[model samples]
Target: MLTIGEFAQLTHLSVRTLRRYHDAGLLEPARVDQASGYRYYSAEQIPAAQVIHRLRELDVPLPDVQRILQTPDPGTRAGLVADHLQRLEDQLERTRAAVTSLQRLLRPEPATLDVELRAVPATTVAAVEATVELDDVLAWYSGAMAELDALVGTPGPPGGLYDNELFTTGRGRVLVHRPVTAPPRTGRVHPVTLPAVELAVTTHVGDHDTIDVTYGELGSWVVEHTLAVAGPVRETYLVGPRDDPDPTAWRTEIGWPVFRLAPG
Candidate 1:
């Protein structure tokens, strides 16, 4: 038998912490004194306490640590831990995105702008497009991209197509598009030709969530440069949130069809 203090010494956990764990039903003492109301632990309980300590050190929540301790099978324990590690990785990625967004907003210099006009050739593409509510755009895009990749079975880079109404109307019509040499089908799965057109384009770096500001800025620039808006805007996602998972490294190109403004 080990006294509470001795158990604490063996586990290298403080007495108060042990008592709290006991109160929380996490680590219970082996026996308690009837008259004196003192707690005592068996030598065998030391290992359990040590395990709990290690888990807490890893920043596992108390509830999760309890689950881990209660889980008997080694495979089950491994799976639980793996799930937690993946969650941590996702959290780290979100934190990095937040940091990048903050830095871009706080930067001192005016971001130097680049604008180009190019005529692209008409091409057939394998595309999955939908009209999605603004709030559900991200979720819808992920599913569409997954479906496109599954059908195309291409591990190479994928591209995107964005219709202008999504921004102007607050209801977005977007496409997760991948260029394919062959023809496409429609109404769920199909190939469509993206007709060749002249585009006025500008590149923006950062997460798409905040990239709209850049889009607006560029729209204003096109007007200032005496470019006439001819057709809807198209955003080609060059590098996505999935590629780097760091928003700072994400890049998107915003292009709008334009014709020269007749001398006004």
Candidate 2:
């Protein structure tokens, strides 16, 4: 038999932690002196103490550690630890994504863009229109684009119209259009005349994660040059996922419907 201090020395766990473990019924001593209230651990308990120490270092919850210790079956004990490890991995991924977003927000690179004001003539298009929640936009867009591609057969680079309410409210209307020589009238694909409008446009080169930064810069330019937004925002995919799998080579034109302010 080894004294509590000896067990602590062997396991490298502090005396205070061993005492707390005793109180928590995690690593009870092999024998306790009733008169002096002293705790003593046997050498056999050293392995269990070491396991507890490692689990705690990994940030495993106390309840989970207790479950692992109380479980007699080796497979059940391993499963408990594995489950917590998986949770830690998931949390690490989320932390990495958040850090990337924060870095983009705080250290923005200087933007050099050419903003143009042009009038787009009315045109007929084969389109898929629907109302979608912001959270579902990505999945919805993927399916919508697939359907449009199958129906239109690569008519032109695909584009989308996003209503202002989509940004203001949680859900709004979205229209995915493909420019075609002759608009088709098929299931969920119909001919629609897109109204003519003047736009303040800028190109977003790369992935959508940082596309908001480009939008902010373009919007600021519009206000500085005295332009008022007129209608839903338009996105023209000049070179996109359909053309290239590499996001670094993707090019999208973000067009905000705008009208010049009258001279005061």
Candidate 3:
């Protein structure tokens, strides 16, 4: 039997941690002296203590550590550890994505995008419109766009209109349209006339992950140029996944309906 100090040396765990583990029933000592209040551990307990130490270092919850130690089957033990490791990996990936997004936002170079004001004429289109939750937009758009593509058969580049409530309330109407030669009255695809509107437009080149930064820049420009937003936002997929698999090659135009203020 080894004293608590000796066991601490072997396991590289602090004496206080060993006592806490003992209190938590995670690593009980081999024996305790009732009269003097002394704890002693067997040499065999070293491996168990080390395993608990390693798992704790990985931020595994105390309850999980206890479960791992109590589990008799090796497969069950391994499965628990593997599940925690997979969660760690997922968190790391999310952290990396967040870091990359922050770097794009705080880069040394200023976001200098060319803004244009243009009047779009009224046009007829085959479109699919729905009121969807923000989280479901991507999957919903994919199916909707696929349906449109199959029905329209290589019409003009696809575009969408997003109501402001989508951002403000987390649920709103979205309309995806394609300029076909003529409207096809097929399932979920119908002809609609989009009215003319003036817009403040800017292009976002790359994936949608960083598209918010471009939107911020363009919105700021509109305010600085004394333009008031008038209607729903529009997005034109000039070169999207349908045109190119490479995200870097994708080019999307963001258009905000706006009316120019008269010069003071």
Best by lDDT: 3
Please provide, for model 3 over 8-62, each residue's C-alpha lDDT reduced to its tens digit, 9 standing for 90 to 100: 9989999999999999999999999999889999999988999999999999999
Candidate 1's C-alpha runs over 4 A off are 1-20, 33-38, 118-124, 133-139, 149-158, 162-171, 180-182, 191-200, 204-233, 237-251, 256-264
Query: Which ten contiguous residues of candidate 1 have the minimum total lDDT?
Result: 180-189
Clashing pairs for model 3 are: none
RMSD of each: 4.9, 5.4, 4.6
Tell me how candidate 1 scores on lDDT.
0.79
Model 1 over residues 110-133: C-alpha lDDT tens digits?
A: 586788898878867888878888
Q: Kindly indicate the candidate among 1 and 2 with the higher lDDT.
A: 2
Compose the digit string of candidate 2's lDDT tens values, residues 32-66.
99999889998889888889999999999888899
TM-score winner: 3
In the predicted model 1, the residue pairs found to clash are 166-172, 184-191, 185-190, 185-191
Off by over 4 Å in 3: 1-94
